[model samples]
Target: MIISTKLTAERLEEIKNHPTSYDENSPKLTKAQIARLRPAHEAYWNVTPVKKTISIKIDADILAALQSGGKGYQTKINSILRKAITTGDY
Candidate 1:
C-alpha cells in the first residue's frame, strides 16, 4: 500500500534540522535551471498515488480511439477525468 504524507510547516522544520546524505549533494537550482526543465510525458507525481486495479467497460469506438493515440492512453484518460472533476465539466 502507498502512504501519502503532507509536509506541514512543523514537519518541514524537523526535516530541515536533519539533512539526509541525498540532500547534501542536491543543491538548490538557479532560475535558469528551473526554467530549462520540461515536464515528463507522464509519471510526474512527486509521490505517486496508490493505484487500484479494476475492470472498466467503455464503448468500443471510444476505447479504440483512446488506444489509437498509443501508450499512456490510460494516463491520458485519468488526466481527463481529474480535469472533469475539478471543473465540474463532466
Candidate 2:
C-alpha cells in the first residue's frame, strides 16, 4: 500500500539547495515523552502483511537450512518463500 513518487531531477536539485528553518519553540521529546508516545504509535504499525499458519512439505535440507538460523526461523522461511515467488526462483 506504500506508493512511492519519484521527484523530478530539477525539483530534487531545488530541494537539495534549499535552506532549512527550525522552530526554536518546538521542544525535543524527552525519554518520558517517548515512553508515552511509543505504545500508541506502535499500535497501528505494520497492520498489513497478515500471517497465517499451515502445514507444508519440504526437503529435510531446506528445513534444516531454515531451522539452523535459530530463533524466528519461520520468519526466515517465509522471507525465502516470498523472495523465491517474486524472483521466479521457486
Candidate 3:
C-alpha cells in the first residue's frame, strides 16, 4: 500500500527543512475520526521482538531468581542468552 512520488532535490530540501510546517495549523481530528483509525496490522508492532514466546521449563529456583530481577526479567533473560550465544558461553 505504499505510494512513491518523485520529488526534485529542491522539494526534498524543502521537506527536510520544514517537515512540521506542512500541516502546522491544520484542524485536529474529531474524536469519532480518531476512533476510526485502524489498529496495527503487524502483530510484531505490538511485541517486544527481542525473543519469541516458548514454553520451556526451568528449575523453580532459577525461574524465581530471574524473575526477581524485576519487571522485564524475560526480556533481560533473552538479552543475556543472546550475549551468551554470541560468546559461546553456554
Top-lDDT structure, candidate number = 1
Better of 2 and 3 by TM-score: 2
TM-score of each: 0.45, 0.43, 0.42
TM-score preference between candidates 1 and 3, better one: 1
| Residue 17 lDDT, candidate 1, scale 0-100 | 98
lDDT of every model, 2 decimals: 0.76, 0.75, 0.72
lDDT of 2 by residue, 18-65 (tens): 986657676666555654554456767646787897999899998898
Candidate 1 residue lDDT tens string, 1-90? 743377888768777798555455787776567656656853564657688888999999988999999999999888888777645467
Name the top TM-score candidate: 1
Q: Which ranges of candidate 2 are over 4 A from the true structure?
A: 1-47
Order of candidate numbers by lDDT, starting with the best: 1, 2, 3
Model 2 C-alpha lDDT versus the unseen true structure: 0.75
lDDT of 1 at 65: 92
Model 3 lDDT on a 0 to 1 scale: 0.72
Q: Could you tell me the TM-score of candidate 1? A: 0.45
Query: What is every candidate's alpha-carbon RMSD to the true fold?
Result: 12.5, 11.5, 14.2
lDDT of 1 at 62: 86
